[model samples]
Target: MNVALWIAAGLLAVVGLVGGALKVVTPKAKLAAMRGGEWTQGLSDGLIKGIGVLEVLAAFGFVLPRMLDIAPVMVPVTAVCWMALMVGATVTNQRVGQGKLAVATVMYLAIAAFVAVGRF
Candidate 1:
């Protein structure tokens, strides 16, 4: 279970880092032009950046606390936050008619839920 939790968290961290970094660095226009990025069209730049920041933070939260042997409770908390973020992503994708992206977020949400339940 521990190994599985670590694997899940690692995967989540990698995704959060990559996705968040892209959101932070990419311009709104570019993101909106991307295939799965149409959802950004309905959001403000600041909100997008804010979500990116949260994602980066959640990435760290998923690993750092437990790895450092500190407040390991943060792992599950991060999982919950990731779940919420994924839910929002799912809804936003659905609104933009990005069914594929919505399905992807659902997969991520499932992974987060698995990590949350396993860690808790």
Candidate 2:
């Protein structure tokens, strides 16, 4: 379970970091291509970038504090934040009639919630 949690954390962190960096650095055209033009349907570029940064920060929050054994509470906090973000994503996608996205968001949220319970 611990190994699984760590692997999940690492994967989540890497994805968050890479995704955030892309959002921050990529142009609209490139981003649109990557998202198959779906990402921009409801979200502005600025909002997308902002959420990306927050996700990256939350990913760091999941690992850094716990690794250093200082303010380790941040790990669970980050997990909760991630879960909240997924919930928001799920709701937003559902509102926009993006059922696939909503399902994915819920899946991710479930993983985050499981990690939160196990880690904290």
Candidate 3:
């Protein structure tokens, strides 16, 4: 169980890091210009950046506290946050008819939920 939870947390952390980094770095216009606009549509630049910040923080939270044996509860908390973010992503993808993106979001949400449950 510990090994499985660790794996889940690691996967979520990497995903959150890369996805959040891209959201933080990429220009809003550029993302909106992409096909289907599923990733950035219906969201303001500030909001997107804020979400990115949350994701980045969650990424660190997923690993750092638990790994260091300090405030390990943050692992589950971060997993919950990750699930919320993925839920939003799923909705966004659905709104834009981006089936693939929606599927990916669902997968992330499932993984995050698993981590949350395991850690908690």
Predicted structure with the largest TM-score when compared to the true one: 1
Per-residue lDDT of candidate 2, residues 28-109 (tens digit): 6677676434655657888888988888897798678878989987877888889989888887877767788788778878
- Provide the overall lDDT of each model, using Cα atoms, as 2-decimal numbers: 0.92, 0.78, 0.87
* Model 1, residue pairs in steric clash: none
TM-score of each: 0.97, 0.83, 0.92
lDDT of 1: 0.92
Q: Is candidate 1 or candidate 2 better by lDDT?
A: 1
lDDT of 2: 0.78
Of 1 and 3, which scores higher on lDDT?
1
| Model 3, global lDDT | 0.87
lDDT by residue (1-105, candidate 1, tens digit) is: 899999999999999999998899988999888877779886899999999899899999999999998999999999998999999999888898999989989
Give the runs in model 3 whose Cα sits over 4 Å from its true position.
none
Q: Ten consecutive residues with minimal summed lDDT in candidate 2?
A: 34-43
Per model, state how many residue pairs clash. Answer: 0, 0, 0
Candidate 2 clash pair list: none
Better of 2 and 3 by TM-score: 3
